[model samples]
Target: MANGIPLDGGRHAGTPTVGIVGLGLIGGSLARRLVARGIGVVAWNHRPHPYAEAERDGIRCAATLGELVDAGPDLIVLCNPLKAMPGVLVGLRPLLASRPRITLTDVGSVKGMVRQQVEAAGLGDRYVGAHPMAGNEHSGWQAADPALYDGALWALTVTPGTDYARFLAVARFVTEGVGNRIIALDDTTHDQAAALISHMPHVVATALVNTLVADPDRNIAAALAAGSWRDMTRVALTDPERTRAMVEEDSRNVAALLRAMAARLTGVADALDAYDDRALTAFFALGQPFREYKARERAAALAGAERQPEERTLAIPAEGWQETLLASARHGERLVCLAGDHTAVVTAAGMD
Candidate 1:
């Protein structure tokens, strides 16, 4: 399809029947959102606990992985927890082998580890990695909402061996299927950025709350907590077990990031203790670029509907499309959608 330049702008064969392999918060929300958009979704969960509610939400509940595979989905999204990915992949291996037309993807927070697991399962060629920048502290089917994906940005990872047709399928699935934007990247880049922005910050949030809880004046602190405290510690309120699993999956990157964060924090503490003017000045100004970036974002959001983020088209080479997209993403351009099999429309609205 990449070479063929299909006139339909690289859309999947038909309105795809998406197979979802989990019924938890992210999975449930995706299934609900797809169903709401009039796309058929067949879903299977490790337990049938959410089947009834999912069915009412118009998601077809499958009793087994084989049943889900039999639905003839264009792609199967493995939304299961990282801990359960191996088992789920094992169950789908034989079924997917029979249905060679199917592509594979997952919504794991950490990309590098997931690729290893998928490759170990012998599904590497069929795989793509996806991580949605969408979630709140709460999780589970009970917290699932179709609106959770509102204006979400997704990171899609690829390798040299990734089939272009398969990649296009997943791209369309994100841009057109879910009405979201994507940034193409490789596993290492995705993992490192994720650690810096999300994984390390989560640990920092946990430590902030833990420090408060261990304080002698904990009750006073709780009573005095307001917007700043709430914002700082909000993510720590997530299920501890869930946060632990996510951090452990990307332990290497998270640990490295934690060390770097600790160094920065210790520098600030030293500056504060000694009241070193130079050090304190540098410390306070460390985040100026980020603050300016946020200011620009807020100004853009408040700007009139007449204006929008800058947009442009990219010519994707048939031979090295992956490299092209990766470079564009690294420079902070986001793929809005594919204009054709070899051309992509990207926006300049992104963090440097």
Candidate 2:
């Protein structure tokens, strides 16, 4: 599947050298993975001292962005803080002319802005936006793991400016080297979907846990803590600045989801007040399967040391002619909805 696409053009075949621009968890993990596979890695970090850590790990260290560029790596993986990309882009732009023709990707959680910057810089053909749906509470190189990407679902966002061939090459490289399955989408859709699933959930979990802790008898709730409470609030322990940037930058989408959740909660409270045992029971039952599905999905993604099969193409069709055509071209696929509109009559299919 590598298909003879040179990661670094000047290098001979079987050379798996990769350049990483940051020494954070994502960057360091990628470096470790390449080195473990017998691939050379040349990495750089803005903080000079981190180079010592990279040296200790036997990974090559570049003193400047130019040095990394000159090293002629096949791939340049960007792993800096999400908020720091714009500034880094400014500094890296001058080196673009001198840089080798290597495929580029970023591990930024949010893609819209990064996509925009890549396009603005006229490097769209070589750059792809990537988000590996995995991380830990800790940050920095100290938390790096070669297997961090195993079984994770990584979203590879291809904007209009991207080169399709390079996109496919990068996708295959990710699955083969990083051990992640690829989910493809355009930049806008990717960002919106992430805002709904990844960003909004974090805010909701943090808010729910904080609310419970605000009670004068908060310690009592802590004493009652179990796996469920801890599981639900695990994301609240992520890096605060990272979470804040995600929420604030995509405020519109996150806020919309939050409002919908508030409405659902209010409906549940109303049902309880009216002694509607049937409605409350229905709500509980509806949530049960969702919880079960989530547990199964999580287990599937992190089940073993081996990487999962790459997910090729998956689409959800809208109720329109346009969606029908798009689905057909995307493949002979049917969009199955598990849940209907909230106000619709409850049916078995909806529950399923």
- By TM-score, the best candidate is 1
Model 1 lDDT, full chain set = 0.87
The Cα local distance difference test for each model comes to 0.87, 0.69
Candidate 1 Cα deviation (angstroms), residue 76: 0.2
Q: What would the TM-scores of all predictions be?
A: 0.95, 0.79
Cα RMSD of predicted structure 2: 8.1
The sequence of per-residue lDDT tens digits that candidate 1 reaches over residues 1-352 is 4322122444443333789999888999999998887777889999999999998888889999998998777779999989999898888888888777788999999999999999999999889899999999888899999899999999999988888888888998898878899998999999999988898889899999999999999999999999999999999999989888988988999999999889988998998899889999998898898898898888988995766889999998878888999999878799998888778899997567
- Model 2 residue-pair collision total: 2
Per-residue lDDT of model 2, residues 1-352, tens digit only: 3422334455653343577889888888888877776567888888877778677776889888888878777678888876777777777777876653677789887788887777677666688788888887778888999888775767777654456556655665665556455555666676777888888999988997889878898999989989999999999988878789879877888899899989989989999899889988888887687787667556756975474422222322333323332333234222221122111111111113
